[model samples]
Target: MNRIEKRMQELQQRGEKALITYITAGLPDMEGTKKLIRAQEEAGVDVVELGIPFSDPVADGPVIQDASYRSILKGTTLRKVLAMVKELRAEGCEQPLIFMMYYNTVMSYGVQNFADACVEIGIDGLIIPDLPMEEQGELKEALAGREETVIIPLVSPVSGDRIPKLVGDAKGFVYCVSSMGVTGNGGQFHAHVAEYLKQVKAVSPIPVMMGFGIRTAADVLPVKDVIDGAIVGSHFIQLMEESGYDTEKAKEYIRTFKTELNA
Candidate 1:
């Protein structure tokens, strides 16, 4: 098992759910992003979803959209992000890092080349929100012999009958989008979120994590029992922005947030 699978299994053994967090790479700059990730690992975040900034992020909300834009303005590219990951690994950061980006990023980087780069840099997984299940074959093929880095699938409440098929061969974990819309908590969950998660958990062999609108512990409470973890993106970005993108301050916020999550 890779770091993700082992980490999830370790959490299960300890009877604790995962607490995943997201941050746009090069938000304040590469060094700051590196510091933030190290801080997250120090603060006990189970997985860190390093978002690759893209011009068109359909799955993200205003907070993330702005962050991505800022990162892009700073000249952050897919190559820089991968290089940073390599540096992080060299620095002994063991946190399971997952790249959450649009399909265009991968295609631009070349499928096989991207897959090889991920394995070489010790990246544990990929979360391509726009890549549909049916069209995943090419990347899957590129990653053929490489099982270390698995493609994570996303399922929404409206997915209905597609949930099982989406997550059937999923590795690491299945990301369950808590609501119908994008990455923020401005709206309420689909009426039957609890039931929807139950359905995902029933069919998924790996851990089930709910993202989108999962900003705090209370947001996760309702479906906490049905999921193995929660992914907080916009709220984290807000925290960093509120701290003026100060790595130390963001780390403090994450520590406190994790305390509540585990309580």
Candidate 2:
């Protein structure tokens, strides 16, 4: 098992859920992004979803969209993200890291080449939101040589009967989008997200983690029993943005957020 699989299994054995956090790479700059990642690892995050800034991020909410735009303006690219990951790995940061990007970035960088680069740089997995379940064959072919890189699957309320088929292909934990909209809490989660997540967990052989609209630790409580973890994105970005990228504030917020998730 790779780091992600092992980490999830380890959490399962401990009877605790994971806390996955997301941040756009090069939000302010590459140096700040690296510091934020190290801070996240220090904060006990189980998995860090490093978002590669994409111009047309249809899946992201305004909070993340703004950050992605800022990050792209600061010149974030797949190559730079991979290089940072390599540096992080070289420095002995063991926290499992995954790339969360649209498939266009992967295709633009060359699929096989991207996969190889991820493996070489020690990235644990991927969560390509726009890649349909039916169209993963091409990606799978490109990943044929990877020994441990995983492609975590996603499911939504609109997925209907395809939950089983989608989770069946998951190598790491399944990422279930908690609501119909994009990222950010929007004040509250969807009315029936808990039941829907329970259904997803029922079919997912690997653990199930809910993303989108999960901002705070309180958000995890309703779904924690039904799923394996929570993925927070826009909340973190909002925090960083509000603090104007203050290094200490970013570090403390992530630390406190992890404390809340584990509490």
Candidate 3:
């Protein structure tokens, strides 16, 4: 099993839920991103999702949009991000690293080349929002022999009939969009979120994680029993922004968030 699968299994055995944190790569700059990642891991984050900044992040909210824009302006590309991950691995950062990017980025990098790079750099999994389950064949084929890395599937409350199809061959975990809106809206979850997650967990072989609008422990409490983990993204970016990208401030938030998650 890869780092993600092992980490999830470890957490399960310990009877602890995972805390997955997201940060835009090259946000304040590449070095800053590296420091923030290390800080989050030290603060008890279980997994890290490196947001590969894209020009048009359709699923992102304003906070993430601004972060992505700044990162792009800073000249962060897929190549640079991959190289950075390599550096992180070489530096002994062991937390499971997952890439959250658009499929266009992968296509531009060449499918086989991208998969090879991920394997070489030790990336645990990927979360491509734009790549539908129907169109994942090419990437899946590219990753065929390499079972260490995986393509995580996403399921939303509105994904009524497609839930099974989406998670049927899913690896790593199932990312459940807690609400109907884009990331960082911090709105209330759909009325039957518990039921929705129940459906997903019933069919999913791996862990099911809740994301979107999840800011604090309170947001997770409603579905805490249903989900295996919580993903914090927009709120994390906002924290970094508020602190002017100070690593300490962001780490403090992560520590508190993690404490609350376990409490």
By lDDT, the best candidate is: 3
The lDDT per prediction is 0.89, 0.84, 0.91
Better of 2 and 3 by TM-score: 3
Q: Give every collision pair in model 2.
A: none
lDDT of 1 at 12: 90
- Which regions of candidate 2 deviate over 4 angstroms? none
Candidate 3 clash pair list: none
Q: Is candidate 1 or candidate 2 better by lDDT?
A: 1
Summarize candidate 3's per-residue lDDT along 26-72 as a digit string, tens digits.
98899988998888878778899999999999999999999999999
Ranking by lDDT: 3, 1, 2
Clashing pairs in 1: none
Candidate 2 RMSD computed on C-alpha atoms after optimal superposition onto the true structure: 1.6
Candidate 2 lDDT over 1-263, as tens digits, reads: 88999999999898877888898999778988888888777767789899999999989989999899988988888888888888888999898999999999999999889888888888889988899878888878877866578888989977878999998867889988888878885546667887888788788899988888766778677666788888888887888878876767766766676677667
